[model samples]
Target: MTLLWIITALWAVSFSLIGVYISGQVDDTIAVTTRMFLALLIFLPFWRPAPWRKSLRMMATGAVEIGLTYLFLYQSYHYLSVPELLLFTIFTPLYVSLFSDLLARRWPRQFWAPALLAVAGAAVIRWTDLSGDYWIGFAFIQAANACFAFGQVWYRQQSMGNPLPHRARFAWFFLGAFIIAGSAMLLTADWSKLPATPVQQGVLLWLGVVTSGLGYLGWSYGSTKVSAQQLAVMNNMLIPAGILVNVLFWGGHIEQWPRLLLGCACLAAALWLCRKRTPAPSRST
Candidate 1:
């Protein structure tokens, strides 16, 4: 759990920093498009997955989870500060929980504590400082999280029978994502203005290959050994990790230490709840 926390925190910080860097270089659409395209290329040699037969449900999730999620997230970076963003980003667990219940035939109570902790932690982080602009981003983040939750459920369902090898499945997922994102770019982009600096190109490459590609690989590798509770705990750490990286490296706003401390406390409480042992369900007589 400790090692997972450290690795997941590092991944989150890398992702946050990449977001900051790319936001400055290219338009959000192009940034997402380019990243997906590059990620596709990187994954291609590894697995060479064929495109899956299109289902309306899968297509809908692809649009919401892959395309729209990135768009809104990129837009939020422009409108909201990092800590403010983190406040909303932390709600991922809540979205995951609610959606998980809706999808599962049985309403499992396993997620309640972690969900509460994540919400409370986020509140502690942003309660006093949150502004109207941040709320807009929060709403967008909620939508993104919902899409992500549903997408995960969909992937699990569809993949269970066909069972594309893990490497192949990832390759296919990125490829599918690129196709949608690329089409959107063709419809919306202004190609006349490409990123001008080497730094911008470098950032784009890192965002595509390292953050998007390698990050998922690292996560999968780490997740195999960690319990669900540990994974939940590791996720909450992304908020502080994002804050610290943004402030130290990218000159992000960091005015209130008390709020940050409170946020950490909230996150710690959430992880503690995860560590508690829930009794196994009893068999019916």
Candidate 2:
């Protein structure tokens, strides 16, 4: 959970950086590929070949979670407006709950309640007028959300019985992610849009090294320390955090302060409801 909070705080800055720097200046495919490649480099030296099966599963997790999630996300911008993309992502917590339920073959209402509340909280912060266009983008964003949710649930469940340290074998995770993003870059990247300015290159370097590299690793490892409900709640924490960061640093305005506060209150309540009196680590990762 500490890791989750740290990553969330760092990623708040990352979102703004992408919006201000890399979104239009660089080819999306190239940017994604570079981030994955750099992240892979971070953990590549730690990869041990002795645990081939575990490495394969880790690769599969990365491929679905960050790899396909980002791919679908970027592609969706072509079909949907930015507001639509943001709005659609609010349901990610719901997917986290649903996927966890499906994987366990049991639907617990208690788990679903907090997840829905998190969704409501995120929706409150993000709700706005819809353009009624780009319905296709809705599907794309949902796919992205499900990929992320499923990956978190899958990793948390599997990591319980695995005795290896997460850092020891995390390289394969980024290798699979790089494979997916690199393939997309090869197929669709526009070479002319590659970073033309020092600032753009610097931003990519920071995002790849710090944001994507450490952020993803921290988020995945942290998921192992909490319950599914807590993970679901944490998934929506980024909304208010991002908004606060934007308002403070980027001169963003709140259209409705009361609405934002109310949404945050809902999120806080949801998190509290999921809290346990005696906290236990799911397993020592």
Could you say which candidate leads in TM-score? 2
Residues 1-285, candidate 1: write the lDDT tens digits: 555565566565765665666664577778888877787677677664344563344445445556666776777776567666765666555544444445554445566777677667766766876677766776677676666545644554554455455565566667667777778788887676466778888877887787666665455445444433344345566776777777777777766779877876776666455444332211110
Regions of candidate 1 where Cα sits further than 4 Å from its true position:
1-7, 47-66, 107-132, 153-162, 220-229, 259-285
**Native-vs-model 2 lDDT?**
0.74
lDDT of candidate 1 at residue 220, scale 0 to 100: 45
lDDT of 2 by residue, 5-64 (tens): 999899778766776677767888888888888888998778777477877888888888
Off by over 4 Å in 2: 76-88, 107-129, 132-137, 253-285
- State the displacement of the C-alpha of residue 99, model 2, in Å, after optimal TM-score superposition: 1.2
Worst 10 residues of 1 by lDDT: 276-285
How high a TM-score does candidate 2 get?
Answer: 0.79
